[model samples]
Target: MTTALRTDRYELTMLEAALRSGRAGRDCVFEVFGRRLPGGRRYGVLAGTGRVLDAITAFRFGQAELDWLADERVVDDATLAYLADYRFTGQVEGYREGEVYMPGSPLLTVRGTFAEAVLLETVVLSVLNYDSAVATAAARMVSAAEGHPIAEMGSRRTGEHAAVAAARAAYIAGFSATSNLEAGRTWGIPTMGTAAHAFTLLHDSEEEAFRAQVAALGVGTTLLVDTYDVRQGVETAVRVAGPQLGGVRLDSGDLPTLVRETRAQLDALGATGTRITVTSDLDEHAIAALRGTPVDAFGVGTSVVTGAGAPASGFVYKLVARRDGTGADGGAWKPVAKNSVGKRSVGGAKRAERLLRDGVAVAERVVVDDDGDGIPERDAADAARAEGLTARPLTATLMRDGEPDPQWLGPEGVRAARAHCAAAVGELPAAALRLSPGDPALPLVTA
Candidate 1:
């Protein structure tokens, strides 16, 4: 396997600042602000809170980070002063994880001031945006699978931290388990593994290798049936493990054809009870192609982790609504915006309304303000959401009143994503799952 170094350039710098002074109760406000995709996206999933939490923990501001920050002095003296005394003290509010969201929806809000909130932006977005994108893609794939088990094995394709977060995201999107050990350790996800070609190649013969593995791992161990000869591998696997062999996995060649022939062979050999799994160059489109095949599970690597072939959505963080030093509603309340084309953002706190027709999500719209009032209802309201489903996903209370609450989410927090993804199954527009360019876009209206 190819290998390379993974990097987190700014984390140490910021954490050092947090570590240096390590102050407890500083007020700050952190907000998540991003807009629609190029083609207006009406609905979004609150995808990556679990992964975001990971980075926050990593933001420990230890001695190493402090040394780097001092060595470079990335910020001025005043900025450094803020960093040394960093600790968020405020409250936060946002749409619950897995809730359907929309453009201008505050995915999250951090309520600590200056140092506390500002430093967290880079790290939090790094985890949330990346993992959320992967989770969104995985949700679509899981929907297509119709309850088939999904195995994630994309660690080789991404950075180390990204690999871990991808596993969490995929889980949140309803995947059954991951091949990432780190994810298993950090997030409590079920970890699974299948023999690679290397294992087979290490043995004197494929038969000998299969025997050794079955002996060590039991008959339930899945046999990789595509090393040298697909049919030969399957036959050898049967000879060694008999009719009760747990499963035969195909990693190469045409998947549908392989499953058909492989199933026929297994059945003829009285191994009908054995399951079939497929992997290799697969994506959402590929998985969709195997609708009624005998394939029992899918091992998705690159595409699912990287976002169903959509590498990354251009999501950004902006100060859409801030309490700029002004005096309007008892304080300064001027809306500020960075008016650039294609990247313009609304100024002011925002909310998202997930409109439902019947009991399913139809689209999402945005409402901006600074108040406790909920979102306004539209002309047609689904019975399930008549009470209104607005998301003010950002607030400023991760670290509050100079001390952090022990209520921080653990690594496995993405379970909620998985549950929500399951809940949204029947609600997703089928056409939206297509890989083609021309389908109805997720509608996004800004007010």
Candidate 2:
């Protein structure tokens, strides 16, 4: 499957720029830096490792792409030639897929010669932008649900590949399962679903629909109860299928009231074990609203798969460091940088640090240095700085040589990582997690 970049606004020189500059034995480093949506957003989630891998797999240049490169005349023959044989023989470090990151936190760090690190800017963002947005939304949904499981069934509702990736990212962000059949088949994510309204509409009665589903899919099937009326549906469901039915889904109507009253009905009907699941424009906020409800699981759609408030993380991979000049050994140095309004990216090889100020992470900063003294910040800036703490940055060695990673984690492992992130999220101020109109801006320091 040769999946090219879905869109082609990414410049060819992005890769070639680093390579052409780095070939002179000068090292270049790229940092992905950005913040959550304004209004003091608490934090952002790292998303899109799967899509990043896909882009890396499809990062090769085909004839059409090469023609565009040539037509643009973005680089010289030498740089393009270097690209023809290029593979990411570099090191990548950053927040894991589900990690909670603050502003100035390097969501991802790419280190290699100038060329290799720079070439990957666009495709990486394409993956991270959409996926991270969805993941962040999914995380909020999880938090709102208060431990209620979530299902992902937004594939057909979205585009094809978007659906699969959304389901995968949602699972990593703590969704209990997905409803996309192919997502289940492909990623080993547990799939859950029931008869749609169409199934019930196809039958003569809601009772008939429930009975047919229980017969075909078994008594463990979750019955859709709101097609007509939830109380009456549950009553009919119990009469036909007996007690101990699996669950009943509510698609429309006032959910909190419905769950409360439906709970009474099911319990009265001796179907106490039956659970209530709700789905109807359920975003993180709606999930939060249903916290005390009798709802069991939430099927998240538009809000999760499409990033709810801030759709993309706006993570930008920029060359922050390159050779400033020649070294004492005459090997030359690659000093990097990027200075733009509202988008001043760091330059040259960089390292990031998260320092705990009295057991609370009061500050996060990035250190730019060529030869590290184990103190990760810029030496020149320290002299100019009036006050700040020096700490080892947080970018880790994720990929080396050229590979997917030494240990490929499954959805379960990612789920564990998400748990760890959730714990970290607890340490941050409570305001950042709110999905309401106001989110306090979390401050950061990049030295």
Candidate 3:
């Protein structure tokens, strides 16, 4: 499907204005970064770069879209012609998906003509902000779980499409599986779901429901045991599925107490091997509170898909550098920035690397190139060596000349991102894993 209309009107209007003013073809560099970590987050996990690439690829103005825009008089004929041929034949560089980021990290950089690049601001920010928020929240939950697997069951708590995206993002940030089937099919994420409360209520009794589920899904299926009475349901489940029942889900009540009681009951009933999974409106805090309990897994919904408490990762895309003159290839780059009160921006194309000591991340080093030429690999390495620390280059070439790097695209890309997230989070200082509100785990050092 065409994603051209998934943008704000101002993008096209600005494109039209720039085209008429003869500045649309000017070379431009746009960078995406966050001013501050939302909700005092220690770090932000980068997600949705693959989705952004897909969106950019599908950002075509088909006949239907052009017809609607013309009918609404959204732009003039000249702009419509431009839209008909709108392909982002540009270079895109950014931090790899699932990487941890701090303020001023320069998460994404788009280098293209003014017209092509300006039209991408809204779509780029929309994907990065929402996906990164879910990923950051999921990472926190993963840390709080302290090794228990988390299932993304928030499909019902968010928009249908957003639910799929959230599932993908959560998995990239260490979630074990998702209840969203589309996410599984699209991104190769593991899919998991047993049954909801309604399924239990559909039968003549809880015993009937347990029997039906076990018969269909085997004794290994997780039975919802909190449907009516927690203890009675467990007793009935054990009677039906026997001691070999795979697991029981507690979706309502005091989880810590209930989990302990359920474990004891299962042990007494000779179902000692049965695991306990909790799903009662759990957030990171709630999961942390159950640290020493017998809970085996977590099914997160509202708190995860909605980004815990911060739904958007306050990221902004700004034109940091452009050609000094209107000519596309005739002028040196001139840095540009906004100094509007508290909304100030840094004005240059940048290179970022993580400073590491003994495998622990110490700081984020951002080098601004005012001349618009990116930092060379040897120079970056030399600077890091001079600082007496190992440097890990954070940015990578995501796209070149309009073609996305397949390594960061498809199901394999998701798997790669998931592994990268694990490594990235592991490299942070031990204090970074704490759930308390505090400053970012690493300070930003700009050069």
lDDT tens digits, residues 343-362, model 1? 77666555555555555556
TM-score of each: 0.82, 0.84, 0.98
Task: Please give the ranking of all candidate structures by lDDT, highest first, separated by commas.
Answer: 3, 2, 1
Report the poorest 10 consecutive residues by lDDT, candidate 1: 1-10
Identify the leading candidate in terms of TM-score.
Answer: 3
What's the distance in Å from true for residue 8, model 3? Answer: 0.7
lDDT of each: 0.66, 0.69, 0.93
Per-residue lDDT tens digits for candidate 3, residues 135-191, read 999999999999999999999899999999999999999999999999999999999
Model 1: residues with Cα > 4 Å off, grouped in runs: 1-30, 38-44, 57-64, 324-330, 370-408, 438-441
* Candidate 2 residue-wise lDDT, 1-447, digit = tens: 433334344455444554455444445567776744532456666767645754665667666755666788866787667656657776677666666676667677766655555567777787787887787778778877878789977775678878887887888778888888887877678888778999999999888888899999877778888887777888888887789898888889888888899999999989889888899888877888887778888897877777776667777777666545434443444555556676665554556655554445555665666652123543533532334533333565566665666333445545555565566555556566687655433466655
For model 2, state the Cα shift of residue 92 in Å. Answer: 1.2
How well does candidate 2 score on lDDT at residue 363? 56
Candidates' RMSD to native: 5.7, 4.5, 1.2
Which wins on TM-score, candidate 2 or candidate 3? 3
Q: If ranked by TM-score, best first, what sequence of candidates would result?
A: 3, 2, 1
